[model samples]
Target: MSGSSRVLIAEDDVRLAGMLEGLLRSEGFDVEVARDGQRALHLGLTAGFDAIVLDRGLPAVEGLDVLRRLRDSGITTPILVLSALGTAPDRVDGLNAGAEDYVAKPFDIDELVARVRALTRRASAVVPTVRFPGGRLDPESRTVTLDDDTTTALSERESALLELLARRPGQVFSRALLLEEVFAAADDPGVVDTYVHHLRRKFGRSLIETVRGVGYRMGSLS
Candidate 1:
């Protein structure tokens, strides 16, 4: 949290992102702006940033998904979810998705900067990988192994999506939650189905079951 705390601003709004960037710069924190979810994800995964200011309505990938993916991949950098959806549910969802803190939009730049500093100042904790029936999913490695014999690797998005379903085997995830929790808000809802399809192919057609107009869930290993 010194003059070297790097911050990533994942917001699509040109003006807001820029304003936040300038504010962080003035505060002596190294700042980077990612205008869309793709760039956000790319930078977030490849770069070593200290803290993140994420917008829920990110263009290509929703901010929550980015947060979820980062957490899923063992990137426990401090994160603050910044968005206009300040409803109780929205705040809960963002926090539940893995953000260390949540800041609603139209926020005071000074306050936002303070929160970012607070996040970086806090001590970090290690999040362990998720375990499911007949397999172990190591988010840090982005790999999954089923049946104790073959280990299958997943792509960035695939790993995030599967990690969501894998975290709770019997719990059904609605398409809306999938979009909010795993995919970008601007991303097509059908993208959930597509990823499910791909997961089916990778984990087997029966590994993920469709809930008939509801959503998808991790299928029973038996």
Candidate 2:
């Protein structure tokens, strides 16, 4: 692959998740993992990823439910469901819930890789980014540059948060929701506000709009 695919693994099985991560990394794919469904949904929604491998059974939220909600939110990223149930109905249920492919547990690693590659091949032609009048945000590089040709690097959390808001300019994201999506419930909601403040200093106060009691939104990039 000329470019590595950003893949998310939302499996509760720690052993399996580690193995998958190692295998995917070895294959030149950028991989990240979530131990439960909540983290899966958050990271999947907020970050820019090429494809997802979702486990049907997960804690905090079920994998199927996560898939459904992701689809509902208009995120059309390719998703492959991993499940122990491989009955006709099982595959049907997963497909009906918006999974692009279904793989029963105990799958061949090589086959899994092939399936993931297939999903990326069919991924939609949408590249996520946020641009303002004089600056642009690059999700992959985690950097932002302004009109003056000056650039600033962003922390992982900052990049994720900015990417999410930039993808939907003018859409106000509440602090709590931002925390969940960007920090994955691992950090406090205050982190959202703190990062917003930090970004304002770098990108200008107007670029990141505060929604008063609500959350924040990307200012007019045009």
Candidate 3:
């Protein structure tokens, strides 16, 4: 990684965790260790990281549960699962639970680090900084910066909604479309309106324009 990429290590094995942390740190990654699944889940939800190394047999909360919850909350951080369960079904279970990659326990440290580096590179390349009328949004950091240079952090859903509209400025998107794209399919379309209201309140009323009897589009921001 060219820049310092933050990584979270969620492994309960003391010796193994120490080794991973030491190696990752030596490789220039800023690493944080979480000894239990609860701590891992909390950090994953609240903090920002380029990638995460998660252990499936975590204590307090299983690693798979943590992964699912992170995805449910709209966290797009790349995750790699480390598990002793090396069966085909086990790998599928990890991937299905939202892990980007699965590594069987007793893995090669060099290979694991390489996989993490690849994940961070892929993530950085896919999400670029989005500039709109009055501000620019950094999707990677989930923050928006106004022309005045004031920056505000956004929740995962808020950032996703804003980025979607900002990317296709002035393109009308209906509530149903926004709901399906930004939220759970089971979520009511009204949730779109709710989030739009949130964006306007945080930014300004002119941040988004509502189309009468239709939907919403990017506003002039003036």
Pick the lDDT winner. Answer: 3
Q: What is the lDDT of residue 105 in candidate 3?
A: 82
lDDT of each: 0.79, 0.82, 0.86
The estimated TM-scores of all candidates read 0.56, 0.61, 0.61
Q: Candidate 3 lDDT, tens digit per residue, 1-222?
A: 556898999999999999999999999998999999999988886566889999999999999999998776556788999989989999999999989999998889889999999988877777857667777889889999988999999999999999777755636888888888788755578889889999999988889999998899877565
Summed backbone clashes in each candidate are 1, 1, 0
- Judged by whole-model lDDT over C-alpha atoms, candidate 1 comes out at 0.79
lDDT of 3: 0.86
Error of 3 at 92 (Å): 0.3
Off by over 4 Å in 2: 1-3, 124-222
Name the better of 1 and 2 by lDDT: 2
Q: Encode model 1's per-residue lDDT on 94-160: one tens digit a residue.
A: 9899888998877886787788888877723343465555666777788987755688888877888
Model 1 lDDT, residue 72, Cα: 62
Model 3 backbone overlap count: 0
